[model samples]
Target: MKKVITLTLPGELIFTRLAAQTAASVAALVCGECHPKDNNCEFINAFELAVSEAFTNSALHACQDELPPVTLTFIAERHQLTVTVRDTNEPFGIETPQPDIESYPEGGYGLLIIRKVMDTVTYRRDGDANIISMSKKL
Candidate 1:
């Protein structure tokens, strides 16, 4: 069986935490439904972190004016989970940079952390939407 959840929110910094929490809550519910016997703490943590980063990035970098809407979709299977975040902002190129952890930069670590936590991370522009897709294996 496959489960899916979708959430839409305003693309504003103020809504970033709400978006992240919504995604995390749905992910936890789907994970529990898929694997009722075992407590997948690590998987849940990684999914939450990756989804939060993606939501934060979209909220921060994707809105131009009027605060467009951002859409988040979570799909869960028995052994895999996929998250897709869509925004109406201009398509920004995705460049994975390896930031030196020792330097301790103030920002620019969201994508890095997302890539490290998720099993697969991808970004692309589709029509007028910027889409970020992330997946994790249980």
Candidate 2:
């Protein structure tokens, strides 16, 4: 059996904590016995970071008019947990090259961090919505 949680938050940077915390909770639930409150385990930290980055990226780049809403959907399976962040933003290439490390760029590391933390990362334009889905094995 799979468990799913869906949350829609205001498209703003301040709300990233809500989204990230929600992700962490879901991860803890999926982890079954290894809760972060008791012990550090599984991909709770990674999921939280990836969700925070995704929510922040969408809030910064997506809202063109009035503030929109970013929807986070978490699907927890027997052996995996997948999170999809949905936004009404313009499409962008998912395979963007990693930023150079020597120059020490200040930004441009959101996708890189997400890719490194999650087992799989993907982006796609779904009609009028853009979706970034990240999955990690349990």
Query: Model 1 segments beyond 4 Å from truth?
Result: 33-40
* Per-residue alpha-carbon lDDT of candidate 1 for residues 20-83, written as tens digits (9 for 90 to 100): 6665666667666444223466676677778778877877776476788889988888888898
lDDT for 39 in candidate 2 is 41
Positional deviation of residue 21's Cα in model 2 after best superposition, in angstroms: 0.7
Candidate 1 backbone collisions, by pair = none
TM-score for candidate 1? 0.86
TM-score of each: 0.86, 0.93
Give the Cα-based TM-score of candidate 2 against the true structure. Answer: 0.93
